[model samples]
Target chain A: MHGLPANLEEALLGLVREKLFEGGATLTVETDLFAAGLDSMGIMQLMISIEERFGVRVPESAVTRDHFSTASSLAAMVRRCAAPA
Target chain B: MKALSDSIVEAIFARAAEAPERAAFVGRDGEISFDHLVADVERWATVIARLPGFPAEGVARIGVRCPDGVQHTVLMLAVMRAGGCAVPVAGELPGDERSMLARTTALHGVLSQGGEERAADGSERHEIGGGLRWERLAAEEPCFPVEDFESVCPAFIRFSSGTTGASKGVVLSHGTLRERLDSANRRLGIGGTDRVLWTLPMAHHFAVSILLYLREGATVVLPEGSLAGDLLTAACQYGATVFYGSPFQAALLAAEASERDWPGLRLAVSTAAPLAPETAGAFVRRYGVRLSQGFGIIEAGLPLLSTTGEDPMVVGRPDDFELRLEGSGTEGGLCLRGPGMFDAYLSPWCPRQEVMADGWFHTGDLARWEADGSIRLVGRLKSVINVGGSKCFPEEIEEVLRCHEGVVDARVRGEEHARWGMLPVAEILPVDGSSPPTDGELSAHCRARLAGYKIPVRYQMVRELPRTASGKVRRV
Candidate 1:
């Protein structure tokens, strides 16, 4: 609820934060999430959460952590992938 | 590094002695309590120790086949107790290789569910497995004087085919074991309440993490076999809270969630290889859980990514070790620096210099760093196929092939040609048992998803593509 976008980003961030907090980190958007903390395994969860929450099918190419590195990038990705208007 | 002392065995013995009726291991064969398991170990370890030839240093070089179901865990601890090494062997390999491995380690003994006797020198044959019996050596249990070992003492050894085509032993020290266990235990919040599903054999480092969970008194449920449906049933039956496997296993679970009952699983972890986007998304949609992928090779320790599911493609961050991508230009490689990395491959041919240049262990995988700096594995460098002048990583193309609705599996390999030098070949495995997708259909599928140069020039509709023992699509 606090970061990213609505329920979609919320669910995504919630899972992200669980791992972030597990390592006792305070991660925000634009943070070098993958390099700073997020790992390959975390990306799998993020993609799963975004699709489940927003009902969007994220292309495998787009799921790379590079797209989600920053809050703005992740938010932009969500806006693009969320089902049509 | 923590030593395998009399204390661990004492704890199991105390638990069993305290509550002889408490369930120790439970599975399809019914539940065997602490009393039964310990009693068996107490009876077996003595015979195991006396088997004449268990090497002196590391306790038990005891190899078990495909794992003897769940009872193998107790047997492992007991072997550790009797000052023996516990070697976990994956049954996916050919019988010849498995047999060679048993003899290569100078095994003290070999155990399996049902098999004939292996002629091991000095080592006695303690047939815990059902069926055919061999003549037992003297059943006298030797009194073991618990000896503390250095961090480098060989606690267990796993055989993996490294850069060389042949299998090479990767020995892990007790320190590395404890380091990984402690890191995963504390960082992942995996403890007594966690019951993990073991789809892969415990002999590998991926399975090594399960031992960490076990030390916390957690339950590990082994899959019935490779079938995803069977795995789902085991997860539900064991009330498994966590699941782990290679990307393929995770994908299959996601692909077939509705067919299997998996309501209790809270965590689904993917490792060993790249996790397809479909696999990650399907699992989350069906189970409301994330199928997290982690970065680790044979040399590096089992690195954990964060739980924060931010992006599917990003490998997330480094774990107990540091991950660095080296070599600039087109040929650079991935490198890892941390405690979990092995000291060296057992092969003395190159020492550790080939992979571990300086302090970093070069991972043959290459990737592009995202803006957030998360890593994405493109594919093995060796698997890169040259399409005319341009370079195409097979994983990129394979991902496209997997996205097709009817395509269940796909393998992209570089094949030599008289004109093109090398062309990409696409091998598709259909969802149904029928023939594979046609060339035109596959072409159309690729034309939509890939670049002009990335598409395969030739398509082969084969019943199956060759795969490694662990089920990875293999290419020369």
Candidate 2:
């Protein structure tokens, strides 16, 4: 297999760790972002980071509490948006 | 001591009485009429008066800590209505910062809701109505002169940035607020038919925005969220005519996939921070409604607004205010002599006469005049970094960085950004030069101490930070 990243989930977790907060080390794919101190301001910053990292535009509608709950959920949303029409 | 005029809350009451049935606020929870709004404000004001340690004569300084909504608006107005100066304790402040604000302001009490917690130390917490609780701090002597504060009939005490260091507690008197509202409205022209879509936090922008809208008999449309979809939906449903928000929001709405053109939108203004030209361009292209740039500050109200919508940088001619450039040539520090200038600074007790002794309030912006006589901001003379509208000083961040044992010294600077006006970057001189503190360690330490936006985006290891001749850290 090619030396690509394991999955979108891991990439997003890496992003949350590097760009957003320091809780990335303790955070698993299923770790709750809100529990880890993700606030309204954090969500806005995370959205910008996701857009830059994934090379995709997340619609305002996609910014819901559920989709932003965990790294896994965010990766799923990113995958859905990044996929071809 | 100067004699006082009518309060802004009283003016709001008179305006509400003129047309009681009209909608004052239209939110996701439905519309609330002017009469209902007035009634709620009065009821809360009565409740505030009954609270223990409610001042018998002189004005009480009460901190308002609530989520951004109609309730927040009502409680602030109520505090003013009850003859207390309202201080907005921003929800983002850490516990220590909150304690600093409470101590510095010498607050008589704090009206806060659940979710955001500050320990009740030497203060009694009583459950106030409307899911709000009152933390009545034990009465203590304020650091500043109470008579000086009360003489101007103070309405609001707003802090520009962090509580520590060079933070200014800008005090805006009731008469000053009224005067500024009138002056600002000369350009805004918001009237009864207009419905303003509110997006910015009430804690930061209530004095000029929310108060002005209510005073002018306009309905305020409070959106469910800050997202483009929510804003658009609220705007369309509420017949919102005016859109006022930050450039970041304008960029988001511009990038939105929705094809529905909000035809009712008339005047869209981007304020709080500098508006990017790209954001202005995209918004105009998206909605066919030109975006105007507003130049507003804590010390001075909305004085300059770009009316022609030609350039985002050229925040248009002063509205009912006089402006001057401090230095000789075209480019210098922007200065203004205005009707609605702040009354005083709280902690040091500097009055208007002293601060404006030179007959001008020196704004820390470096600007140049265009051929058309419109002012265009080029740079800042101060070292404050504006991350998308929230401001943080370099010294504050450097202090936090220096707190880490590994850091010997640090310097933070605002690096120009394409999207956000600026992003903070740090240079740290480490104790062990061979093994400097990693980004993760620095970030984690900063995250615990400072607001997220104030935290430096990137950390660079250095042997030394440049210093001025006086041995002070050099800032560009």
Q: Write the per-residue lDDT of candidate 1 for residues B218-302, one digit (tens) a residue.
A: 5656655444566677788878888877664565566653455578888777765555566677778778888776654555555
Cα RMSD for predicted model 2? 3.7
TM of chain B, each: 0.67, 0.96
State each model's CA lDDT, in order: 0.56, 0.83
Query: B1-476 in candidate 2: lDDT tens per residue?
Result: 11223889988988899999999989775789999999999889989988987778789899999878888989999999888899998776666567778888899999997653662356788887789999999877788998888898899999855222467698999989999999899999999899999888777788789999999999999887666777888999899999999888887788765767888999999997898888889899999998999998888888899988878988998657888998799999998888889999887778988988999888888998888888999988888888888888898789889999999999999899767788889999999998889887887788766666777877889877889999989886
Instruction: Report the number of the highest-TM-score candidate.
Output: 2
What ranges in model 2 sit over 4 Å off? A1-40, A47-70, A76-85, B1-5, B119-122, B161-165
TM-score for chain A as predicted in candidate 1:
0.67
Task: Kindly report which residue pairs in candidate 2 clash with one another.
Answer: none
**For every model in order, what is the iRMS?**
17.6, 4.0
DockQ of 2: 0.27
**TM-score, per-candidate, Cα-based:** 0.59, 0.91
Q: Pick the candidate with the highest lDDT.
A: 2
